[model samples]
Target: MKNLRDEFPLIAKNKFAYLDSSATSQQPKCVLKAVDDYYKKSHANPHRGTYCLSVEATNAYDFSRQKVADFLNAHFEEIVFTKNATEALNLVAFSYGSFLKKGDHVLLSLMEHHSMIVPWQRACKTHGATLDYIKLNNNFELDLDDFEKQLRKKPKIVGISSVSNVLGTKNNVKQIIEMAHSVGAKVLVDISQSIAHEKFDVEKMDADFVVFSGHKMYAPMGVGVLFAKEELLEAMPPFLLGGDMIEYVYEQETTFAPLPQKFEAGTQNVGGAVGLKTAINFLEEIGFDKIKEIETELTKYARAELKKLKFVECYFTSNAKNHENVISFNLKGIHPHDVASILDSKGVFVRAGNHCAQPLLRSLGLNSTCRLSLSLYNTKQDIDKLVEALKYAYEMFFKTK
Candidate 1:
């Protein structure tokens, strides 16, 4: 109900209908100020210097980690900061996944982003594990029957997305995790798409590992989080071995730091972490109830408006009502890139391409699609602008013939 665009200077000034929250969200003034303030006042190498400024910097960074942990109902020690979700997944693949032996299995879903897929693919190749996929149903949601059937294969690890970045389908990760665990499989959930829009409680879900990027949640880029149980992190070898990650160094051998610091190597994006904390605070201030209410209304309105256009071919099934804020479609006979270009010219920003989930798009018999993703800052008016722009594109490209 609240017009959140005012809080985002770029959105307010440009007045662009930003419908690509799935790609990366616009930052609020508060988040920007938080990053700026950290650089201006608390700029120092955290955990390296004993000076007052360094101590403050370390505290700020540590506090942000704690904030993130609390945000996901996780233990502080369980949080490991990475450059992005890609790095987080790679960390798991290189560290925890290294334990896989010959003939072991790693189960992934059809809708996983490339970030989730590539790492497992490489890991399986390295460890002689077999990479398997859980097929999608007619509704583009994960086929639970196939998932259970795959579990019988006794996978060593199962990786899945909480929400499909391409389809906007909210998978039942909890149920999948339960099923995987029944077969003694450790589950890693990619929360990059769901963390900003939905309620994610790591403890409640009991996920073995969870990864998300700050950029997708109105925070600064260059910061991501990997949440795993402390014991699991302690057991896994450090992904990156370097200066800060070590407890002590010898000519022949080196000892690593405890829990999280063992995984966070080299200098970190301190400002990004501060901004991420601020962004979480901003979301909390708005609250999830209001967030969901706005997104639900926008999604329904957009879906209805899009359906009215005969040329618009929406990929969602009729019974698929849980596509929170993403609509993937193709204007009949219009290339996705062309549709996106036309929308851009009209000051409507949307995403077009495989959305980094080519496998999922391929499953749907599409190479690419024009995606309109919404956020709390987006409104019905924004959807209206998108509809108008799409209609204009259709007219310009198809009706002329």
Candidate 2:
């Protein structure tokens, strides 16, 4: 397989050693040009006009929605586009929060991004429900035993991350879903970090909802997918009521559009969705399996090389069998921001701070962890640059002292 580095033109530019794919991925020319082409030639408001340009824009937008549905193995009607994963999650929280009662409970893990945790917390507060957090084991994997204990609590919604953005620990979502369902709790997966690395089948996972951002998959920012079971979407009320989501508005009563559009409200991110579809097509052409393999190799190389540094304390299981293509580690006697600054001086990019996963960071008893997240465009050579930068950083920070 020709790796993504060979396929993507941006890598050739040596713009920066980008290891922050967890933050957002570099867009391929195919996706970028798709957005440009849409604006340059076929720009118009979708579903609101009868002209040829409008029809073209509507078709392009609908095609992108269908592509996202197919990518998740979900029905097109179940997919709703939001500004980003945060908004996707907020929509669910706003709608479903109404269902909670005084004693109702919402379950989540410490590993979740704030996108997943904060919404539920606010929902619980508004709807009079309690929130429960699943603790991590010594290895930083969700402690199955702790999870089992929490299952007895039988929360109304069990929200979990498909992968930890900070630690790179992949969650056993299928097992978690099955377990949650057995307890009569619905599951919502925060898949922002996992969607690009592996397959996500909503039906197979039996999740009631799954939220993800487009940018993490090399799609444009400001577009995301919110997948809900059709019935759930139907049962939930409209998230935002406005012109498009309404069927008819009278002085007496108003009616709303069906499942997706009800939540979509105003004009959607038509161009972003088109770019997302193009990005998905690009990934499909490269084969997800190949991307996963390349990332796994890169992660393995990173873990092995980073472990050699005497000052480093690596997180995640060193086995590399269960981890994603990310590395989170701390250099002794140096703050993560300091380490990241030195690495940046070498043109190496990495993510620092809590990674919007404050609960997990608190659990680890640290203010922040330096993270290196890999993607298809990364190679072993990227890992080499990282290791070299780390050595220099360590010498400058620790050995000099």
How much lDDT does each candidate structure score?
Answer: 0.91, 0.89
lDDT of 1 by residue, 323-350 (tens): 7788899999999999999999999999
TM-score of 1: 0.98
Q: Estimate the lDDT of model 2.
A: 0.89
Tens digits of per-residue lDDT for model 2, 132-176: 999988987888889899999889899998888999998899999
- The true-versus-predicted C-alpha distance at residue 65 of model 1, in Å, is 0.5
User: Which candidate number maximizes lDDT?
Assistant: 1
**Leading candidate by TM-score:** 1
**Model 2 worst lDDT window (10 residues):** 1-10
